[model samples]
Target chain A: MDRQAILVELKKVLAPYIKNKELLDGITENTNLITDLKINSANLVDIVIDAEAQYNIEIDADSAENMVTIQNCIDVIEEKLSSANS
Target chain B: MHSAGNDVVAFRLTDPERSAQPRFYNQILSPSEIALFHSGALPSLSFHIFLWLCWSIKESAYKFRKRYHPDLVFSPTAIPVTEIRATAQQITHEGPQNASTDPQITGTDHQITHPVLQITGTDHQITHPVLLITNAAHQITHPVHVITGRTEDLFFRSELFPEGIHTVVYRHPDFKSVRSGYAFLQQALGSNHPQTNGATEPTPETQSAAVRELVLLDLRKRDPNGAWSFGKHKEGYPLLYRNGVLQPVPLSLAHHDQLLGFSYLLPVS
Candidate 1:
């Protein structure tokens, strides 16, 4: 529900796909999924699906496209979670 | 300013069963694209290849436009592939009388045959024909699907291979001088390299370096005396420099799984 909690969950979701464990350990809000973690673009969709299942929320195409960075993913998830709760 | 972009998708890394799921592909394809898939237009191709082909094209188009629009985000649904059609490669026969005078016909017996694809989109139009030549010595009759699509004003041509798919997007039709190529990442990285072993996987940094090396090697062959170097522009687009001077060429680099792809616009002589 909180940013830190969301990040923890996000890390768990991303850990399997990331080849560089060091980068994942040092990931920040500014860390890019493609450029930073070197996650394949094709795998981005899988991340989205995993995040959706983890958060129990649906991500539209617009929000999914903006999930290029860690912060972007958190923001979208938070927005979706709040909207669903409301 | 003519710009070019390219992307490659390797078959080994991607999961075909996962990609065919609606929940997965729904985020990637526009509503119209979904309709086109069921429209029987691509009846022969599997859903997995079709989906990845579209993904590669949109990725290339995003790169092509990113040079001009630095703030652009990649939205696959936003940049749609409006049309896709398969056409046979045309073979022109030149008679001896006109063979010498015809500039288009290079040899006396047969003309070059190309697998052509015509694609039209909302904001831009592209016609991509993969030039496969047939001569007295060899005949290449394999049909290649030429997919042309546009993102904003850019046009792209994509070729599907048994290994994967490669797509290249450019600014305009007149920028037909845009050329592209792809190679297996393992082969490009060198067969003797220790990392080439199956025990260790290739990192993105290593893959990027290998593609840059491959491009530079090809460029050096064209201009042997020029000192060639590859670097990125301030806008984060890959570029080439010769003798410390930035070449007018617009270049793009992409690698996925085991395939490395690069495309560049040739400077007018």
Candidate 2:
């Protein structure tokens, strides 16, 4: 439910595909998904798949376009979380 | 007349040495948004399943790259390629007669077929994780170079990979390419140039919990009907012959969970 917790969980699922050694070591929140973490759009779909499976929420195709960076990915999750809670 | 008919039937049954029918499957994944995967900064984020495939290919390349220096590729099918260490080609095959030259290999002519991953199943997996950058031959050929990279810089830099690709460029061999290329993507938000590379290999620091298999082949000379099959290697690599010399070609790694396809064929004696 918490944004940070959700982000952490999402990162865990997405981590396997990413080469962490290329990123700044010790990843934490505020890591730029695009620049710092280097998450691409194609694989982002897989992240979306993993997140939906984890939290059980469906992310629409249009909304996914905005989820670019780590922050964007987190922002989208927060939006989905808030909407689902309401 | 009856005896002749029986002899033909017997010959068919006795030829146990015949090769199995080659397997081929259609691409199961989509062709949409493939450029997006290629444009990313680090391919690791999007090409999750493919990362493992590429790493395995790179490892296999190391075994033969130094010793054999393989030049031609005969992948019955080609898909988006990510892992290559150092070699000449990225060529895929159409068949025995139609070995179309890779455009990258045509002009320069300095090519080694770096890690050719031949299999019957890429058609099903292409669109699952990302869009493959097969050489333009996908339209006309059996094997394709779904995607390719040359120098280290093009892979890691942002400028090199535009649009859907910049953010993933952190792992690209160059950081400046990212800074320079993104100058416009962030500012004008208009125009995107796709920086492509030639040979790419996964470094030790980058690979993850990927699963792959190693297989061996024995290429004893002068036997056209002579085929070698061993039960030990779960993943099978095809052996190639060009100009009367033999070359070893690797198939993709065997998955652990996969039930052996031809388990019953092993000789009891």
Candidate 3:
């Protein structure tokens, strides 16, 4: 429901795809999934699917594009959750 | 303005089933592209590879346009693949023999036993040997698909490989002067390059360093005596320098899993 909580859940969703554990441990809102974590672009789709199932939210194409960074992912998840509740 | 961009998708690292799921593939491919896929244009490639091949093309086009539009965000469905043509390349190796005397096969020491694919409509050519190594002679025929696509006003060309796919974007067909290459990260790093600085680790930092080093190596091969270096433009795009002067060459680097890809424009003489 909150940004921090969403970040924690996002980390769980990303853990399997990211190969660098050290970078994962230090991930911040500014951290980029492709550049910082070295996660392959192909895996980004998996993360999106995993997050959709994890949070029970539907992410459209526009929202997925913004999911490039950790903060952006949190923002998209938060927006989707709030919109669903409303 | 001269520029080039490329992207590589290592299919082995991708999940074929997940990639084909409607929920996932829908986010990437538009309705028209899905219909195009159903048209059986590329019958040899699976649905998942088709999806990723389009993604690689769009991603490369994005990189090409980002030089002028730095605020661009990559929305795969927004970039469309308008045309696709497939051709089979039959490569046969009987045994160790003399390499082809064709000048087009520049700098090739390995032998090519069969005729290469010659596609019409575009100036399709392979300046480098298709098979880098042929220790044991064998025969095989593989399907290579050429895809043409556009993003806004920009156009791109892509080729499918056994393991992955590569795409390059250009403003015009005749204006497309970009040369591209792809190799395993380990192979690129295995070659001694001073930029590695003796660092052999496969970290994200080293991965990017290896790409730059590989591009520099290619540049040096073209002009042996040129003093070359790599730097980034103000818009965050990669650029090359020769003899302390900024060269007009635009460079794009991409690495995923163990694969590394790069493309650059040759400076006009």
Best model number under lDDT: 1
- Among all windows of 10 consecutive residues in model 2 chain B, the one with the lowest summed lDDT is B1-10
Q: What is the TM-score of chain B alone in each candidate?
A: 0.75, 0.18, 0.73
- Give lDDT tens digits, candidate 3, residues B177-231: 5566666565566636332333443566777887786676667777899998878
On lDDT, the stronger of 1 and 2 is: 1
Total colliding residue pairs, candidate 2: 36
Q: What C-alpha lDDT, on a 0 to 100 scale, does residue B173 get in candidate 1? A: 40
TM-score of chain A of 1: 0.96
Docking class of 2: incorrect
- Across B143-246, the per-residue lDDT of candidate 1 in tens digits comes to 12112232244555666545566777765543347656666655566666655555578788888887887677556656789898988787778878999999
The TM-score of candidate 2 is 0.31
Candidate 1 residue pairs that clash: none
Per-residue lDDT over B63-167 for candidate 2, one digit per residue giving the tens place of the 0 to 100 score = 222122233231212322333221122334321111122111100123322222222232222211122232222111112222223221112110001011111
TM-score ranking from best candidate downward = 1, 3, 2
TM-score attained by model 1:
0.81
lDDT of each: 0.69, 0.29, 0.66
Q: In model 1, state the lDDT of residue B118.
A: 30
Question: Candidate 3's residue-wise lDDT over A1-86, tens digit each?
Answer: 89999999999999988767777789999998976788877677788899999999999987898998999999999999999999
Candidate 1, number of clashes:
0
